[model samples]
Target: MPAATPPAPRRSAPDSRIRRMIRIALRILLFGLLGAIVALLIAVFVTASTLPSFQDLMQKPNGQTVRVHAADGTLIVALGPSYGDWLTYDKIPSTMRDAIVAVEDRRFYSHWGIDPVGVARSVYVARRLKAEGRRLQGASTITQQLARNIFLSSAYNYGRKVREAIIALALERKFTKQQILELYLNRVYFGGGSYGVDAASRKFFGHSGDHMSLAEAAIVAGLVKAPSHYSPSADPQASVDRANVVLDVMQDAGAITPAQAKAAHPEQVQFAPEPKQNSVRYFTDWALAQLDTLVDEQTAPLDVWTTLDLKMQKAADDAIRANTPKDLQGALISMENDGAVRAMVGGTDYVTSIYNRTTQSQRQPGSSFKLFVYLAALEAGVKPSDPVTDEPITIDGWSPRNSSRRFLGDIDVRNAFALSINTVAAKLGQRVGFEQVANMAHRFGITTPINTHPSMVLGTSDVRLIDMTRAFASVSNNGNAVTPYGILKVTTTDGTVIYQHDAGEPRVLVAPYVAAEMTDLLQTAVNTGTARAAQIGRPVAGKTGTTTSNKDGWFLGFSSGLTTGVWMGRDDAKAVPGMQGGRNPAQAFAAYMRVALQPRPVEKFQTDVTLPEWQLEPDDEAYYGNPDQAFGNEGAPQEGDQPAPKEDVAPQNPDEIDDRGPPAERPQRQRQSDGDKPPQLDQKWLDGVLGNRRQPQPQEQPH
Candidate 1:
């Protein structure tokens, strides 16, 4: 009975079998885990093999800085890459290196390029933060940071992180610890357009990195996490607080004693005076903007030899600063007769406002636009001495009035233009057809669209100051079309020319006589008209323009050698009370030109066109009026005096006169004589000027 009871309590075979299976399963799982770790190591090794060679790593491409030089080889500015003199590991102070390590990576020397413990901790924190919906913080070592900045784009993703880690490992294998630390210090960004520890040290302390004190080194090290946020220039107090944290960390890491950390932490940091952020910044910006179209590619650093004359640039800056009101803004552009931009002050202060009013702004030209209208009339058989009534006039339901609101009854074309009579310009624009006026402007290099309204003659159309200055240069250059250009030549640092300006054969767009007459007319303006204030004691020709409500005032003028344009207005286009083209703009023009043209020899305009007698019919009272009464005795010639005679006019047959349609439809007249036939019009020039007009056929006049 006892034996049978004991047999019943015997162990189950199934339980023993289950225990054996559990042991086998545990052994298999352990092997599988080991295989996975080995596979991961192989993947990491393969990825690291793709890294750059040691030489390639050492010669990594940092963005090149662009150096802008004036035509005479004076440095205008240096921009683009914010690099400074490269420093070797030996040149860097031990204190500076220790400060960086204490703040950036405490175990920098102990860890293999990628810190496994740091990565694991970062993953754990990241998981917790993800559950709580927080921004993921970075746990990159200095080596990892250098790898990203040197070889990778600033993309934050799993794939990018993997590549960054593998490259960091490769960097550790190829370069010594000191070399890695040196590279990191040389390539780190340090706010305010500074790159590298040397630049940062000099920018904040006005001294080289090797000469920095413990406090100064800590300040530089603190900026590594967030350069802009901790910039001393932007927020000095915040930057000081960040440096204190670095000092405490240095003390804990035994890089500095507690007393030393305390002494350095509270020490006042004297930062260097901020460098003139962008001297001639507006000009540099505009020049670089043009470089995009001028050069085929900007693959390397370029030495841009600009048309800028630094002396003239300084003059323009002084003139704008002295003449422009504090609240209001202004722009000045000075150029050569061949369209070489010599000086450009885009705004009163490039630091306060970078809006380039000279090249970017398109304000109303006001009366300054009448030059084109008068030129169109001159091309259409109207002489500068032709009769022009400055009485009230209207076209297309739009009435134009003079700035003075008083009409100068009937005046000659020269006086009418000199006085900037809005009515006469409007009437002439209507007579010659607005299309012709627009064409004339286009030929003079006014690329802005011109409305065909009669008011366009009064400069109601908006135009850039650079374009307007270029247009006036045509008058100064004897009818040659002027194309405004800034960059003379662009070359690499090694002197390989990338772009060179070759102003091709000059395009004579305006008739020679027309240019001479236009110059004469504009000279009269500067000498005795609304632009008298713009005179610079030289043979100068210019026009004054005031828009409606005094919103914009302009003085655009040129001498034999230089052409300068000044614009004064509020950036908001609001009216500046009591402002006029003859006021501040004219004064600034005069001031700048006096200094700009001081060295250049004074040259007079060539008045070469032949003169013709004034032909007056019995009923031609409008052609010869009371000059004193017309011009208020200010600029009017003593009564009965006339401007220089025009070229001879060929007698027109009565039948041929009938063939000429109404004033608006008539083709531009040709110079004709008894023995000579009328010359055919230059259709190409005409078409270019008068956009898309039917070409006129050459016709013989009956003798």
Candidate 2:
């Protein structure tokens, strides 16, 4: 009864009740807003604590400058302070400034530090894209980009973005809008190791940014997104395509008229000639890696002289690009007989990949490895004319067949090597001892592990292109071991010689007579054997090698005192259809050699080796019957003896005997009555081959 009476007396209007509730809600919202602002301020201060001072940030990055020069003292590249000069806002071309704004940030001029509109739009777009399983997009202003380039890394994460934003706001508070733009123009990266608009303009157009044309400005602007992908020196057409997009965006932003944008023929803009090959970047990287080992401290500037021939580098680059298929990659290493690496093309293009295949990659050398095998055999006094049976043979439990899947009954060592006869090589490895072959490789400067399996005679082990090039360079050098060197000298800005290459007396690894015999055999290989495609109208000696399934192709040889090795394969070690050493790799070798040897006079090999005089019976049709035959010009298939299939015509290109041969389908050959015997394995003979010479140690190569 008491509660009923109090309720009746205290009845209030519904409108008043609603007004009271609204006031309570307003207080809660105001408090929540204050808490959020305080939390944001704390985050900003914490991020700002890790930033460098504004004045310090304005200075160049903390590192000593390194100037890399070619063999002729031509400046190849500079490491630090790569900018041409600090360009003021007025000195930058208006077109370039406008193009950067149009492509990088549409609201650059209107925003203080962060654009709320851009942030919101980017968030919405990012959410929508995430729903479709796409990468998140960024909404960075020019100030933010400057903050990242100067202070932070290019990492993408909430923490990094928060730090980036804090630094961006501090930059806005410290400088005027024009000052910010000036700093950006002087510090942004423009690819090809260029920093700043002036440096990029000078590098690409051979001029300053102050005089850039509209199209050239657009090209430079387009590189901001991805420097390497749109590098003018690497891919001119791609730069033009990206520049056209920038032009369209600039026109849409009202920075230029439609007619002006349409008239901008970026496609016709001719870039300046690069003083160095993109491959030279690979060489510089290699040289730099050894710099730390050579110098105790890098606190001061440096001047590095490297043994890179621009002409030869250009030729090597062009040869690989012109010969290699689009989907594949190739590597080439060319060194003088003295072991100075003249030209090294690590891959087809350095911009797309930084891997130095010449020094880093280890792939099967295929039959190009036979140089060691034959050298070992020659050291054992097995003359090039010594007869070896090419009939099918097995070592241990493994049977090695020829790539042609057919064999000539008997052939001399010279033809067997020229044809890359696997059976004969297997027999020779067993007769000479596999350990001797491995010792021969190590003596020739091969540092990689060499497995002595019987199949090792067929190059079953992997080797680097540079090492293989050195092996052949030793042969070309008349049995002298080679240590491939790239850097000629290193000095400080004041000309203090910090490091200098020692061109010491050549170390003898193989006997001169054996090397001479091997060279003769290799010459026959390129002149009339599998490497016929490698002939450059001069005395050239090299071998062709293709691996099983065509996974790798190689051609290693020497011409005119210059030794080079060419290798073509996929990174994944997959098969490249229709690829053969004699076809692409040998062609590449020939093309490069033709240009490399142009400036030098043609030279002949040493022919003073003392050996027994021997001659082939004749080029009798009955003996050298089939041009496709591996050997046996004197013997043809007899009655009921089937002719070898045409598919069995070995290109003498690669390694391994075909594993697809049928045991019962083997072709029968006319046997010869020659009573020559194969070299038998004997301890006395082994000791005589090794002699009293010391085994050569693996030299530490500088790449």
**TM-score of each predicted structure versus truth:** 0.69, 0.62
Candidate 1: tens digits of C-alpha lDDT, residues 555-593: 898986788899999999997776678789999999999
Q: Backbone clashes per model, in order?
A: 2, 5
Question: Candidate 1 lDDT (Cα, whole model)?
Answer: 0.76
Best by TM-score: 1
User: Which lDDT value does model 1 have at 381?
Assistant: 68
Per-residue lDDT for 1-703 in model 2, tens only? Answer: 5655444554469878888899988999999899987876775666567556645655766558898988999998888756677677898999989999899889988887889999988899898998999966547999999989887888888899987888787777667888888888888989987888988999999988788999999999999998999999888999999999999999999999999999999999989987644787877888788888877756789999999998898999999999988789999999998888888889998867879898999987777778888887777667777788989765665566665556778778988887777778878877777777876787677778887766677676788999999999988987777888889999999899999998886566655656778898999888767787999999999998777667788899998899999999899999777677778999999999999999999898764212223323433243222222211211222234343221211111111212122123222221222463222223232234344333443673444
| All-Cα superposition RMSD per candidate | 10.8, 11.7
Q: Which ten residues in a row have the lowest lDDT in candidate 1?
A: 626-635
Runs of candidate 1 with Cα error greater than 4 angstroms are: 1-67, 75-144, 153-165, 172-182, 210-269, 276-284, 292-303, 452-454, 490-498, 608-703
